[model samples]
Target: MARMLEISKLTIRNFFCLREFEISFQNRGLVLISGPNGSGKSSIYEAILWCLFNRTARQSRVDDVVNDIVKKDCQVIIDGYLNGKPLKVSRFRKHSVAGNDLVVVYDGENFKGSPSEIQLQLEKLVRADFNQFLLISSFIPERIRTFAAATPAQRLAILGGILDLHHFDMAYEYTRSRLKQYQVELASLEKEISVIERNLEGIKADIDYLERNKAKKKEEAEEEKHQLVLEKRRLIYRIKQVQKELERFQKGKAVDYEAEERKLKEERNELSSKLTQINGKLHSLRQQYHDLQQIEAKDYIGKPCPVCERPISKNLVHRLMQDHKRKMSVVSRQIKTAEEEKEEIENRINELQKRIEYLATEKLSQEKARIQYENELSNLRDKLSFVQNKIDSIEKDISTYDNLLKKRYKDLKKNRKEIDKLIEKQNELNHKIELYEIIKEMFGKKGIRFEYIRQVLQKLEEETQKILYVLSSSKLDLEIEVNNKEEIEIKVYRTGIKKRYEDCSSGEKHRIECALAFGLNRMARSFHLMSTNFLFLDELFDRALDVEGQEKVFEILQQMEREIETVFVVSHRPELQSQFSNVVVMRG
Candidate 1:
């Protein structure tokens, strides 16, 4: 059981769309302020918001808003009461004022405080900013639209502001950031896995190449070793052949051994005899030859005869000596032939010895070549073994790399799984965040507790639906419910079947809006009546409600007014023109 609050008077001078106006309130029944669209019906609400909160309904810049309404020098004054107490607040703009250049004043006898002090007191009473209390036409529509259109983050912010759930929003954001970090980490791990896999592929290629080349080199080395063995055996056989030939040469008869002996003895004897005989013959031939040399050709003929005294004729002596000389020349020719034969035999024997030596030396050279070849083969085999061992080690290393790569991939998969889980958790947190926002927006800070606010909203919705049904003559049984997430769902029960808001017609939608407004008005009236006894509604019946709906609203307002101290309905509706106690008509 509460009373109604009254506004004693309100004066405006160049304030918003209200150029110059003044209005007064009565603590009685309905008082309608009737006007056209631009006749400042809504300006009164904007002025109230500005006077109390130093802001406007449009959320425009303070300078632009002030300039649009107030002149260079003007002021706005609002006077009201809370349960028979004097309340006063004034705002003005001066020529020297630059930005938001408005002043506020408050004079209350109960709390003899300054304007700032009065503002603080009012804020405490309203439990919200003054601008927020006046839910203007544009404000309501904009809020509904924003709620429907904003992104999740924006929605969360708005909800946090409304519900004072900043902590929840912050926690949700932190969790989301952590989830993003984990996702990035997972991506990096995947990239590393790809790089490792590529490296493993390259290593495999190298291993394959090594295996092929190693096999080929091993085969070639073995073949060379076999060839070396065969060459060594052939060298051994050749050495044996040379050795046998050398032995035969060493054991065979020496050419000209006996003939050389005989030639030596005969030559020695002949040399001695020839020396003696030539010595005597040389003396005789010198004397005779000198005598023949001293003679002329004609004398030489007779000189030969002098050597042979038995023949006085030259021809006769010459012929006898020529015969003896011819016999000696024959003997000398035979001796020279024999000496040449002995020399030829000696030369042949020397040549055979040299040939034997050369064959033996060549055999030794072949053996040395075979030994070198064997050593080379042995060295090559050792190198090939070493290379094979290296290849094996490389293969083992490649295997280890493969295992390591597998491990890395496994770890990457594990990281990805962790990221996925974190993302899932993040999504859950996001849902919770959305839930918190919806709760806050529907209910204020006082209704921050989800379950309690949900119950209250449910009750409000139910009362609204009942009011709608009454207004609609029960042709529609409006059903209201609070969904799982605390959202309001309204259904029209027609023909024993429930139809959602979407299934309703335009007129029905208008009725729903009117019903909701009346329900809120009733709630506000009850709350305000606790300390006051007056309620004022401006343009409450602008919806396309029928005559029956209007009558139902009027009846409700009348009943509520009696319960409270007073009620004021401001509207231009012809149906409600005669229903109010007082009427004020404004024209541009």
Candidate 2:
């Protein structure tokens, strides 16, 4: 059941070369839109395209669609009915301002949405995209061969959108993506498993090596510890012996050599002082004796008085002489006594020096002995510390052997468990990889999508042949084939003689193009399950068609008029205008 799209009216203002054109498409049948060059015949349908989709086939830019004379304010309005509901589309651009100013009134209610949103709603209302309208519903002379001439990828993309096969593409991409992810995960797990296996092998070797050497290592540790103990005992005994020696050297009564030397020095100084005093007294006594001898040798009695420079009496002189002799005798006795005292003081000082020298020698010998004993004791203490450290290290080594083996066994068990888990995870990832690989193949372009294209081509071939039969004078048949390469091949057969599209004559190509357009329209109507009442043909019968060829094309349109509500055909031949009752002529 195909719903009908009945376009009632189209209004155009300042669009392209139209410049305020209006036409009523309601209740029309096989109408002729005859016009000379640049008379706005194509602009009429261009305006309708712009109103519905914000697009025109003639222009790339929206501003270019505005009429050159008017220079601004391009508007196109289309009033139509979709499934018996009123649908109105209005598109306006006042000098390209307000950004795609578009509105759609559907079922007598204004639909609120952006231009693109409303466009989507309109497309859904018609059950087709703009490409579908341009390719199937509207037949333009310049674009009639678009589907047949498109590259393989371009054709697939266009066909894919019209057929609504985006889900198949999505499924293919998603499955391939999941497959790749699973493969990467599986690779990582394989690498992890490899590392775990290597680690397990290493652990097994380590456990075996440890088991083989455990008893021997323990025996060696014990033997080493016993030797260290013996060495420690020997060091302790030597340290004790050195300590005794140090104590023995330290216990002697220490003599105060400095005090003894000080006392002896003081006594020697006192004796020397006494001797110096005795020598001084003897020297004075000698001087007095010499003076008395000199006085006796000289006759001072007859000389002037030595003290006063006056003549002196003999009796006075003789008394003075006697006094001098007595003084001399006293000085001689004093000199003898002083000499004896000086000799005694000298002997006492010599004894004190000898005693001080003896004390210094004894002090030096005792200091040397004390330093030797202290050095030996220090050396013994250092050796004892070293031996004690060795003993402690050996004991620690002996204690750790059992614990070391136990830890190795524990690590081996832990690594084995980890390897098992990794293997299990690796298995799980492998299963996922297999599943996704199958899923990827199922959704690929050569899989289910291939079948879909095959079915479409089959239906397309049938429809094209039916229309191509009426358009071709040589009983031409159209065959659209989808090969394994996913390439579409459109072939024309004339009584079983096949020919490529490009090999056809110009007039033949045009007829083929016309039939292909109608065939696609029929296919689209079937696919959408909707009847699109409007069909536009721009200069389909104007060129490359002789009189009989032209009549054949017109006959197809007349047959379509029975089913379609409006069929507007643009032509330059004035003779064909007489064949249609409803005709709109554009004179430029």
Candidate 3:
């Protein structure tokens, strides 16, 4: 929409060797202002900026900017139309012994009102002080070259200002600040993860130790169970042994006590019968001897001769007496034998009685011994039974202990397995975290990531290629590409063969710069929704062009003018001056 900018009038007083000067600009075409060095041609440009914005292009101070050619009281005026609207701006610089004083006026309105009102209106219109926008000279090819030679940050600033992308620059700075904050947060997260992982490792170690301790306890419990079983077995064996001894004692087969008592009683009874028979025989023999003593043998023999009186021969009487004497002797011997037999029988009976008494005493003792053995055997059997029961109970307790130990061991093994799985998972998470850190660091070192900058670079390249085609007169084709490292490189082609940008000539570089500028202009128009009614070309075709190159440049400019409303060119070259429809010359 800003199709025409015309300077209707400009007046300079005491400014840069131009004590008084006047200039006017054409509305729709190129206007050339040219002279030799120090011809006040540059001073005209300075006065135009000083009247509009009240500052110099060289960034000079206020006192120094007061022109040396002006008298003590001097002023400059600039009247123009921006977008067909009237604009009038003026500045006055008064010289004093102490310093120079400055005053400003805008659109016939004086800045003598409240300072608050002036600041508010100025901030609303420009967003910067009016003194900072002034220029004393045209920033042509030399200035562009100077800007290109500066650092990348300075170049970027200039490019940003030209493209009206200061907002984008500010946004980029904000993004960088946020990226730093993210990096700090990521560092904190990494530290926290490290601490957690360390603690996990420590917990794993503790689990391992606890598992080992559990295993030891289980082993000890198993040993105790085994010992208990062994003790129970020993108790069973002792009980069995005692039981066998008790059974043997109950049988009573080791002593033949009843048979010995029967034999002693039979011998005593036989001795008593023999003693009674001997006593009876001795009584009969004693009675026979007493009858013989009553017979009175001597007196009876003499009376037998007187009483008998029959056949009394001396031989017969003597034979009868002899018979009687034989009888008496027999009876006496019988009596003696009977008495001795009876005496022997009495002594045998006494001995047999003593033996019977001794046998009875021994039988009583054997009975008492049997009773004591039976009682002891009963007690032993009871003790053996009790021991056996204790062994059984111990065996059951040992079995229960074994079961518990096995269960505990199984649980411990399970816990150990789970711990191993956790350790493996923790290691995997740690590796993932490390990979993320590496990627984050790589992204941080570059200005921006591929995803964010790729589209912008692609658009730049396409636009640059289109401009290159226009500048090259369709004879040479060029393509601009950005490599993975984010460096911009150009590729050229002739006859459908590609060539590197560095391999091109100086003329090629000039062409490339023009194409790139045009590309930027096109981008601005597209972004701002501007009507392409005019194209402004400064001294871009001055340095690296021959006659043929200039002709080509003129051809392109002519083609653009035909398609658009107007084309303006400012140049000192005679060829360019002759190409224009109108010309105005300045002389000093």
Candidate 4:
């Protein structure tokens, strides 16, 4: 059911040209607002918009919307009802800093809330927002036949928004996005699956290689054990030979290898000290260069040094930059020299390390030979038993290679397990991708909902043409044709002569606008897009109209007035007021 709007009072204070104005809209049937220019009739609509939306169509800047001549607070109030409920809306901007810039109070039924909450409740009641109200409910000044004269594509766009057809577009886009996301996920999974498969293959190859070489490794371990026995025997023989050679050492002096190593170490330490001193000097020079660069970067900050407290010339700045450059160059050279010296010292240390290792090896061998010489001379049986113990240790190492091979098998088993999991996930993603493809097909532009949109467009055209036939006095037939993509073109046949909407006369165009407005409003209600009980014409009939055109418009208005709950017409023609059941007169 369409809710009736009854304005018991409208108050405007210091807003636009309305210093302090109030009006009552309690009467019914054909409300006529007749006023001259600058009489603030239009401001009434502005006040309504403000009181409803906390905004006005007069300007975008709310702060400047107040009357400059008044230099005070601006306010407008529209007290009315929605569906038999008592509703009073008060919209005001304050005169003091303590108050708000815009205040909205909506008292309807049992709900009392803030402006935003009130607006939501209002949209629930009226079934439209501020912009939707202007499009479907209000017929404002200077836009009588505008919608019908617009291009067909442009018409579709406007109708689409009010009809909420963009929701279909949004749904289709959402489906497509999901489709892309699934496809990408599936592709990523496939790549990951491939990587796992490749890793699995590598593991299998390694296992196969290990299996193939297992026997070979066992054979090699046997051979290595035999070679180790030979090495042990050779060592035993060499020990006997070295014992005989060390008999000379027993008769000779003991050379101090440790003392010789210490002498080489002292030389390395002195060279390292020189290198450290050179590096330290280089570091200090580099730091000074960096400080100079930092100072030069902000050379404009001061003319002289803060420590010296003396004015310095530009020449001095240049000299300082040159000195910094020279210092950097010197530091670079010093770094190179220090690095070279360190490298030379490191090389000497490495030479000493090799010599020390060789000396230690020789000393160990000679000491062992000396010990063997003493032991064999004392007891040969104990020395032979020690060599036999050494041979048992080598055999234990050969047996451990089997454990290493088992570890390789364990790794292969782990890789295969991971591969199996990846394949399972891949299969699941593949099925999901298939389902997404079907979903994409269903939501594509030419898919399931496309025909529904076409049907709605067809209904709109039919309703518009039906209204046009009823409103227009001429023998006019309207047809709207569109391509598959929903591009529309309006073709009018007047006495079998065809013409576009742009080619129509002003009277014919006005009739088309009236038809479209009524049809669109009907469609809006039929589709439950938005709901409104009022239609307004703000200076819509003020344009130049001949007698016949005026009569046709009056007929259309009368027909529309009966269909709608309330129709407010703002005009300058007072004679037309007699045609209306209710009249409002405004005086400047």
The model with the greatest TM-score is 4
lDDT of 4: 0.68
Clashing pairs in 3: 14-70, 57-136
Ranking 1 against 3 by TM-score, winner: 1
Order the numbered candidates by lDDT, best leading.
2, 4, 3, 1
TM-scores of all candidate predictions against the true structure: 0.44, 0.56, 0.42, 0.59
Q: Write the per-residue lDDT of candidate 2 for residues 1-588, one digit (tens) a residue.
A: 666777788888888888878899887888898877888888888887778777778754878887889888788888888888998888887745654488888898887787778778777777755666675567776665777777766666667776777878899889888888888888888888888788878877876877667667767867887877787788778778767765764664244666787899898888888878878887888887787777752586667887887877778778887887788778877777777777777777788878878777776776676676677667767766776777666666655655666787788788778878877888887888788777777778677788888888788788778888888865787888777777777777877899877888887888888887777777777775456678888878856888888889878888888877788888777888888899999875
Instruction: Give the clash count for each candidate.
Output: 9, 0, 2, 0
Supply the TM-score for candidate 4: 0.59
For all candidates in order, the CA lDDT equals: 0.55, 0.77, 0.56, 0.68
Off by over 4 Å in 4: 1-10, 22-29, 58-64, 78-89, 94-100, 104-130, 141-144, 164-180, 215-453, 540-563
lDDT of 4 by residue, 500-554 (tens): 8788887677667766666666665666544445666776564545676567667
Q: Please write out the lDDT profile of model 1 over residues 228-269, one tens digit for every residue.
A: 556556555655555555444345423334344455556555
lDDT top scorer: 2
Which candidate would rank higher by lDDT, 1 or 3?
3
Poorly placed runs, candidate 1 (over 4 Å): 1-6, 64-70, 83-85, 95-122, 130-132, 135-448, 524-539, 563-568, 572-576
TM-score of 1: 0.44
Candidate 2, pairs of clashing residues: none
Arranged by TM-score with the best first, the candidates are 4, 2, 1, 3
